[model samples]
Target: MKLLVTLMGVAFITLATQSQSIYSLNYTMGFGVGETSDFIGSPSFRGVTFEGRGFLDDQFSLGGYFSWSTFYEKLAGEKFTDGTATLTGTQYRYINAFPMLFQAHYYFGTDEYEPRAYLGAGAGAYKMIQRVDLGVWSIEENHWHFGLSPEVGIFYPVGMDSQLNVNLKYHYVFGVENSLNYSWFGLSVGFAWGD
Candidate 1:
């Protein structure tokens, strides 16, 4: 019983020090490409993602994200049949992405409607599945790939732990044999807990 009480106190203290930070889940839909077009489709890529953000102080924040993005490509050199555009010569590329960033936000004023804007940069690695039309060409590129992440976001406080915000992020990778450029617009709804 005494041990349980001590654990409860520790939990309470932790909650007190960590400012109630905001967490969110967002959906990303966009298109992009890199070096080998033979292994992936046109520029139409589809992606879904979830990420979390936490406050380090009133103006500083830290966050991380992971997501899967994929698309299909056609190999035009293969057997041709308009009605039979099968998966025979097409490539399906699936990328698993992980990114972490430290952000600094500037709030316009001391009002509830005060607009907040932030900018930050980070790096990520991708696990890639590369397929080809004539045959299946696949490879997994590890951390040898590095990226630059820049984001601008805004927030409107509703009560405190809740808000509405919009953000734009540009992710450019240089470590891949070919640079993979990805850009996304995010619309988010979120809640803050703890602090």
Candidate 2:
């Protein structure tokens, strides 16, 4: 978590010094896949993303991306087993994930007045906090996992200095030790500003 923060800070500073840069704040919706779905099947509407990108040229840019997503579910009178131990009760399960990544993107068009399509990918660390509550007792664990996200998006110019941005991104976080891998698809809608 510390490393992720430090890297994001440095990336932001570097982007701020660039002559041409863009910043965006997005509302994100997430759908869990595979093991993530098995744990929390509900779609997550509580998510947000912030990004800063420095243009290297007309078609390419490098950036820092940070996002938070929360998934939760309540199961009544469920059985849970861990090793030789077993518990039966109402379970409230939750997952909070933070992903901080360095990203690179390539734009397909150079026209300033028209919409531009882009392809991008990010790679870095994911901090996951998972918890389960049974009555008054709770079990919690935190882990840092390596992750990657591949994205496709469009930028529609809405004004001289602003654009409407929409994106579809997929996140994959690798498992560590005894933890299970997590995956999700995210749809983001936002506005971008800058040169």
Considering every candidate listed, which one attains the maximal lDDT?
2
- The whole-model C-alpha lDDT of candidate 1 against the native structure comes to 0.47
Over 1-195, each residue of candidate 2 has an lDDT whose tens digit, in order, gives 578768867987797579999898999999999999999999999999998899999899999998999999999998878999998999898989898888999999987568999999998889999898889999887899899999999999999989999999999999997777999998999999888
TM-scores, all candidates, are: 0.57, 0.92
In model 2, the Cα lDDT at residue 49 comes to: 93
lDDT of 1 at 18: 56
Error of 1 at 58 (Å): 2.7
Give me the candidate number with maximum TM-score.
Answer: 2
| Poorest 10 consecutive residues by lDDT, candidate 1 | 185-194
User: Each model's RMSD to truth, in Å?
Assistant: 9.2, 2.0
lDDT of 1 by residue, 1-195 (tens): 234334434533443355544555545543444443333435434555545555556666555544455555545545446675644354335444443323334444434345566665544543444333245556554443445566666666555555555565666655445534433332333333223
- In candidate 1, which residue pairs get closer than 3 Å at backbone N, Cα or C atoms, i.e. clash? 19-195, 20-195, 41-73, 89-133
